[model samples]
Target: MASDSPVYLLLGATGGIGSEVAHRLADDGAQLVLGARSEDDLDDLAAATGGDAMPLDATEFEQVQAAVSHATDTYGGLDGVVNFVGSVLLKPAHLTSIDEYRTQIEKNLDTAFNTVKAAGRPMMRSGGSIVLMASAVSRTGLKNHEAIAAAKGGVTGLMRAAAATYSGRGIRVNAVAPGLIGGGENFASQMSEQILSSEAGRKQSEKMHALGRVGTPEDVAPAVTWLLDPETDWVTGQVIGVDGGLGTVRPG
Candidate 1:
């Protein structure tokens, strides 16, 4: 029997949006296994969320598989999984290096792939939810976003295909595609930070979103949390846009 309290494996749990999801899940009384490359950050999150900390490198299949195993082993079942592992690269195809392109694929696409591949084993038995972070740039044409767009486009495809492949087994797969977010490890450390650093660049980014400003990790957390909730079991194979109308709307 599945435990009344769901068990969730959060890859990249120390990142901006990931930490928010972890806290929300913890508040909802979900059992969590927090995974990330930094053991210290993971330990801190573990203390705050009351979850076990498992140091993880999401790009490696074995490590992701182990995290999945840890959750099931500790909690008796795995109910949901979300991979917040990603990267942001702002460069045109003409200027992007092959190594940089490959790194983007590895960090964003490969990590999400590994999460779907590994989490399938435990969750298939009792049915669960899986969410991967995607980007609005995948669907919209954004300048100098070549490499990351390609990778995130692959994530969009991977989610759709994996959702189809896993739906019958009772596992639901979804991706949340967010827009130009300003705060968090993702935006703070990446080219996004560089863009938001300059007044002209920041306003340009804000103008890109119909909402008239940039976004925060807080804007993204609830969408993921909602998908992970069992109450939304009927929802699957969908790409939810938490992009502040950036992907599909034109600003006035």
Candidate 2:
């Protein structure tokens, strides 16, 4: 980050975790350029956070690049960028269609790729951070998560490689991998919520985490912002699990 009050571009700004991250940044006095698929949601979030809103589909490279440029152009420079863009698919490979898999890849991995490509040169100007959202399933085996797991696994790979590629330039890249975030008002999380629609499913999910509960937007937002913090600039190429130990522990 260039200064105390840096400019940031937040993709998927209307999502549950994304919205929380925006307000957290706003509280820290960071000027924001918010981008999301829905213009209406973007406007509402922008108004609430006092940020400029840009409607965009993150799977589109040009749109994402335009967003980066908008952030730099509007605020003079971009100090950080975060991609909260992702998808949730809970189906075995046998049940997943090609189109479904493609959509999954586009939503999670391609968005991350486009974001890193778009932000590289701009942030390279003075060095900044890029945080991406990954999933615990990418590292830990979770049945029926094949499609999403593969997509997010690619995100993890991108985060590390980009971190290596940009480290000398002082740009940081990292990811927050969460497990079963219980609530969110986004396309992806809504799909994820379906898995918990049943009491049996909900109880099983809660018990899957060693902490005896699922996570929330509040549980995940701060970690994203912390990685974006200039204070933690030295941290890079890492996947921090905010997963209630689901990715590492099994409850006894």
**How do the predictions measure up, each by TM-score?**
0.96, 0.96
lDDT by residue for model 1 over 36-74, one digit each (tens)? 998888999999999989998999999999998888877
Minimum summed lDDT over a 10-residue window in model 2 is located at 182-191
User: Which has the greatest TM-score?
Assistant: 2
Alpha carbon lDDT of each predicted model: 0.89, 0.90
Report the error of model 1 at residue 46, Å.
Answer: 0.7
Which residues of candidate 2, in runs, are more than 4 Å off?
Answer: 1-4, 184-188
The alpha-carbon lDDT assigned to residue 118 of candidate 2 equals 99
